[model samples]
Target: MTKKILGVFVIAFFMAAFVLFAEDAPLAPSPDAKGDNFLLAADFRNAFAEYRKLLLENVNSPLSEYYFAKCVSVMGSSGGAINPEQLLDIEKINPKNAILAANLLRLKTGSFLKQGRVADAERVADEMGFVKDWLIIGPFDNATKAGYKKVFPPETEFHTDKTYEGKNGKNTWRQLSVRPPFGTIYFSNLFRADSYVAAYAAVFIRAEKEQPVAFRTCSSGPLKIWLNDRLIAGIEAYRECDFDQDCTAGRLKPGWNKLLVKICQKDGEWEAALRITAPDGGRVEGIVLQNNIDIIKKEILPAYIPDDSDTQIDADSGAVGYFSKLIENNPDDHFALAGLAFMYDFKKILDENDKTVSNNARKALEKNPGNDFYRYLAGTCDEDRNKRLEALLQLSGKNPPSAMALFKLSELYSSTGGGNSGRRRAVSANEAEDITKTFSVPMPFREEEFLNAALKQNPDFVQASLALVGIYNRRGTPWSLEAEKISKRLLTLAPENPVIVRLTYDDDLHTTAENAGHYAKLLAVDYTDGNARNYCIYYLKQAGRKDEVLKEYRAFLQLNPFASSIYQRMADYYEGCDEYEESIACLNKALETNPEDIAAFEELGNYYLILKDIPKAQENWEKALAVKPNLPDITEHLEALKPKEKKFWEGIAANPVVYAAEALADTEVPLHASAVNCLKNEIIKINPNGTSSTFSQQVVKVFDEKASMNINTYP
Candidate 1:
């Protein structure tokens, strides 16, 4: 009884402190003093209303904005559309609300997608960037909180290490990529299961301007956050994973700031998602989120050239120069040599810039004969095709082969004109360009074999899985089932990986509206990637979401207005919906965008025929045919629509519908016949639901008005 009273007293004291704190500044309690209670009671409306009232009371409060955004977001997600402007308002009030920013941005994107405002959603996604990568270290036991408490006596010790590896005496770290929406990590992935784990994740954000940034985080277990070594917020007990469950506001210095997280998990699922946002709960513009220590260090380096260098050197050159200086001091510096070789490899034209690359790679390999990276570098620098292959083959033969080496080997084996003895090379340029047929010779080395070897060496390696999935999706010998299984496994392992999602989408194994939306969301975790656009658009169409399809089509065109094909696609979609005017307009725009778009001309020809403009139809079809003399469908279409003689009509009379269609095409004489004949022809072209047919209503209205028309005579 005494202990219970003491606990009550402690809670009361904290509540008092919270009230006092609110009066002093804008901090609010989490479990949210009132909002969480209302939400728990299933009174979402009241919860949302209460949060809104709090926001109105304190416009600048991160606490109020956070709760309000959450309430609105929940309500919006449940069939109600959220206002993007309201979400943006939260950002304006507390830009450092990273969790809220990411959540609200997601909510806003979904709303935009549902409302057919995909462009707005895409724009907001670009603006509200998620902290996609983190230097993750852990799986240290959290038994009785022992592991969590002792992992780092003070978390700052982890940050204090200046090494680019970001490793300290306390723990070994791996750079983990966690994209937004669903990117997560499992304790079992790195350590034994059914055990407690303490994980540390940290990322560096370089802000362009000084502002208060919010770090909103969600995790499966208890976690604490520190900004630039200053302890800011912490949850000491276990909890279920929830989005934006905890957030801490901090002032980000104009330049670089470090955000560190310590998560304590007790068995079961383990994961976390975090983001940094502007004071108003929007993206902190000009912020670069980085996990790679080398990248973080390089980003923070002074932009000005060293006084010794005569000319200005960009960051890349500066990096190269720094390594060059290191090499000048010690010619046998393997690290410097490896760095130079990697830089050259990144340039993608290693053969063109071979001066120091080959020498440096050779020196690095000689110095570290056992290092796979050194071997890989040497292999990249080796100009001899046979020698390069030999080095790569040797690298792959290591105890645990590098994924890069395996990937390179796969590429060499897969390429038709390379080391792979694939069939039929081009006798001429025209022959090479013609893809009408293909011949193949069996490859000496199967790409799939090496990719499978890479996967066996490191099952968690995503690139290997992706490569194998690609092989499974190869044109003639597509192994769709294997691809689907691998893709699903990849998603399970790395939920937020856009590359995996791209492959999954490419295979079209699980194409649905929801999956497409998720795929698009995953893509948004990175900067706007055009690679997934077609898949996203295709999935939406397959799911019968015409509104979303059109919205995305418009959005894509906004970004790439010169894409004539997109305009043609838009026209096709509009025509499918029986929006003839809109279809015609799209075709005209396609022509305007590119006069030589043969497909657009063909589509316009079809549109003109539907409108009964025989001359215009013929003109457009002729133009299409002129562009490409052998347009298969165009010639057939033109021939089919040509006016036929009585004998031809008789020949096709068994198909009366075809005869009626031909008769209807003769617009020279109006058919003042009973409604049945016209209705018969009209029914073939109209959708009962009125969505797919523009003339459904007009046809019905005409039928109603013609109620008095002759029942048995043609006028």
Candidate 2:
């Protein structure tokens, strides 16, 4: 309740701060204006004081009452709760009220929907011809980013017994009533991670007779719609969501017509909107929205099936639920059995490793053996990569070919090492991240062939388009020009897609300040994206605002407190500026966040060493080694500092040999234009018989102010 009140106060504050009035009004701020200021300043008591004065003076004033109610709503008081209807009635008394019509209508409709008054919501929705009710499900596992192209079960059939492997696991259709006026199905809370996600919103409308209607929908993410199991209209772009954004004319059957929509979100808001209206413009009347899948199945779905033909559908258009039902009634129905087996793509029921399931499917295939698609499903469902590859090969040979199979074939080729593999997971010391490996072109012919074929088969296939863009992007030639065109094309398909954003920019972070906005968008979608944060930091630094860089770092930390690696990097930044105290504090915090952070321990040791705190240095290095043994540099450094007869640093005081500051290595650069003069390699054999030829040199002397050196032969 407190949080809700706070949110309301926050919103009201902004609204009040910008509230405008008539030009002829007095110059000084009005009571509503003063109240708004207090709300904005977070002085709730003062804000309420202003509201009370306004309500007392302007008795029965709609604007005054609205402001008072707004303040009360956020104060956690139920005594004078907001009455949207009363407020609306008050506004009606004076046609020229201070409150905007849009704002009033929104509040009224929202309140109605929040209270489960769908009829009220529908009444409000009638103004905009928006659909008020829908059966919605998902935040499905779209981590693979196949939401747009891959056909999930909902596309084939809709049944209560059916469930999809959704984002929350095993999701079935549930009711969603939109907030009134806008009809926005706000699903901002559905996404829990920063990954590509997909959802389904369905409405089964019963028409009096066959009729034509326009389907209207909008979203801030990639969206697609289907009517009665056929693809209709879609826009796979992340644009501002608004009513009547995309429209398509769809035919409704006499019985029940299923309007299925698939929407994909990469980040930020995971939401969608849907509405159906008459072809001419007004609301489609006399249509009942079927809320129950079972009822729809009984009274509607069966009617859509052809009366002339039996239960036969094209191989590609097979419905899993219908086939399962047919097979249940007749166990020996080989065709139905095969059709059911072909639906191995569903992760809910078809477990690839289940022997019983596989045997049953194989038997069904044997009853009607040599079915290429059945074989494809068999191998495609298996965990073995070789099997899937062989299955994909079979599909690739088919007449006209399969776009999906060709796409998968290209993927296999890329992973096995040719062309640009979209992205790979690179695990850091603290977390794993999707690292886009933007490789250069000169892709293998086979990989290129498969991708081009896939695109040829289905030009709008998103995954294939992305792959081809990746390929064209790598080539430093006219192909890059082509890549730019295709990249723009792909952006239209999925503009907010992190992958698309990354590919579009392609490591050109030095363009202008405008480039930072792209990373800002990336961070908005994924706050934990270290790469985006770094780009932001880089741009901030280039702008000569070191403080802003630190602010950016803190902003990311606020979103993800367990980002220990960020703390370590912060430590490095401070240490570079010779702020030893700040560096130590950051390192300590990193250790606190991740106890076994070996890098932080090693860094703490390095800081201690520079500060001439011998014991402190020894302790931290020992701690680092304890976390993970066999760390050579830490082990050697720790032993050398352990109560030596003569300290090891006594030597560095004399010779002052500097080593790598980061990870230890024996790697060296060749001599460039050198001005510094020094050093020679000397071989010291402990054994009298060990000659220079027989012994390996443990330490070689080198010379350079930056990096270089030579050999000193003690002949």
Candidate 3:
């Protein structure tokens, strides 16, 4: 009784303290506050004081120690207080709360070396279970928490539900039907069942409640969620556990939202659950419906129980012998037959050189006539041999072919069949009509009838919408208008999607500039899309904003080091602006990656030529010509340099006569006929005075006669 009374008093004291503190405390400034603001906001000093009091009241409380350590570390001048040794001592107690333990350990180990406690810090850091080799520092208060925020943005919410299947004719998991309208929740593989799958769905509220909204989603295993008819998220089976806690935080407009969740069990039993919470303190525990609790039971289907024998074959190998034996015992087993057929087809594809496997698959089809599975196997064999016609003939009889069959037909028609002239026009016209009606669709819709059928089944299919965009973009009358309409609708569905951004901003710079000018006139406009910004820059450049282009390019380069083309473009702009040295520098860097880049070399050569660096120009031109001797302007450049080379030789040749004359005077062996004849021939060849060649030849004859006499005297 006394212990109970003490516990009650402690609870009352804690409640009163919380109330008093809440009343007195100022609202927290932004979590991003730094320096003095950091010290003042998040109430570091008050947190410290309260933690100190808590420590005094309950000396053994791990929570108090953890918070106290955090407060002390955060409140310290620059580098955190409570060094590695001190934190290590606290972590030794091993607090049960994982989050608190993680936070305390993060703060201590993050700066252990910078605090001049290297050896001790390393030991403590290892003890605290820091796994990653590299330490990343940030401006935020807590790096891990800041990282979480970076990955999962704040002010987001999620909703999801759990599902289960019956095992041995007993309900495995009770269906919780109450689902919340808005909230945040952390979902995990709680039951550890093979078929266990969970989802966290959140709708991000945009500023204008009426504006159309978008959502982002993250899922575990094979999961998919759709907003309206557009798929927002999907994960394939056997993928890594993506810790996407805040995946869905995009702008969501106020309206009716529909979400469909499907999870299939490849192996073992299926079990799952969800937790729903809201950013605004609204909470829904488990899956519960406020109205008509019994109605949900009726709405929900009985849990799906997959037959154990219906096992999938390995993509790499055939089904195991045991499964094959099962098929042998039960010859009419569709699952085993399909599995074996798929395995045979896969192995045949792997060994395409072997024609025997395809023959075997054909035999399987003959034995199991009228079997869709065998027909599919035959089609697969035909597809491997590039015989699409045969595959199509095999699959054509079935009304509403399986997804796999349809996929194959789509590939064949898109790539090869449509290339035939007669078939091309028919397919193009059909595609055009389907696109005209749907305003969107996936690619390779194959037959127009197929697309029409798809639209009939799901009127708002986004693949249909996209396909319409492509068709109109390619062939519609008034192409731009149709494309723009589809792009606008796609933007409403996936505003932040890069493809949509590229599509909507597809027009030339002039159009974008005109749009920007019009948008500027509108009141309270927010035209801050990144694609729009890029388009604006493009238009501004067209409007002769050379300086702005340089500035933006530099800023862009700083952010994106791999933007080599941007650097090259910026260099061209600099050259245009008469900044030759800067241009050369930029071109040189580009050449580092693409050493044989003729364009860059040519540009650099031109820059050098402009600066009157003839030698540098010659060097760069030589480099350019070496890479591509037959480059368009290079032949002309080489021809132009021929005279320069001739001029250089002429200068050297001018003094050659003087050397020859001196050699004649010095030698005992006379510079007789040969020397005189060589000199006269050179005079004729040079024709320095532009004299007639006949006059030059006469002069050469006179010299030759004189040389003959001189030689006679020497003899």
Candidate 3 local lDDT, 163-248, one digit each (tens): 22221111122222122111111121111222332322222111224222222222223444443324444434422222111122
Q: How much does candidate 3 score in TM-score?
A: 0.34
Residue 262 local lDDT, model 3: 31
Q: Which candidate's TM-score is highest?
A: 2
* lDDT digits (tens) for residues 243-294 of candidate 1: 4545566776667777778887776766666656554445566777777756
> Candidate 2, TM-score vs. the true structure?
0.40
CA RMSD for every model? 27.0, 27.6, 30.4
Q: How many backbone clashes does candidate 3 have?
A: 23
| Predictions in order: lDDT | 0.57, 0.57, 0.41
Q: What is the lDDT of residue 551 in candidate 3?
A: 58
Model 1 ranges off by over 4 Å: 1-340, 349-372, 381-383, 396-457, 466-489, 498-544, 612-662, 665-715
For lDDT, the strongest prediction is 1
| Ranking, TM-score, top scorer first | 2, 1, 3
10 residues in a row with least lDDT, candidate 2: 432-441
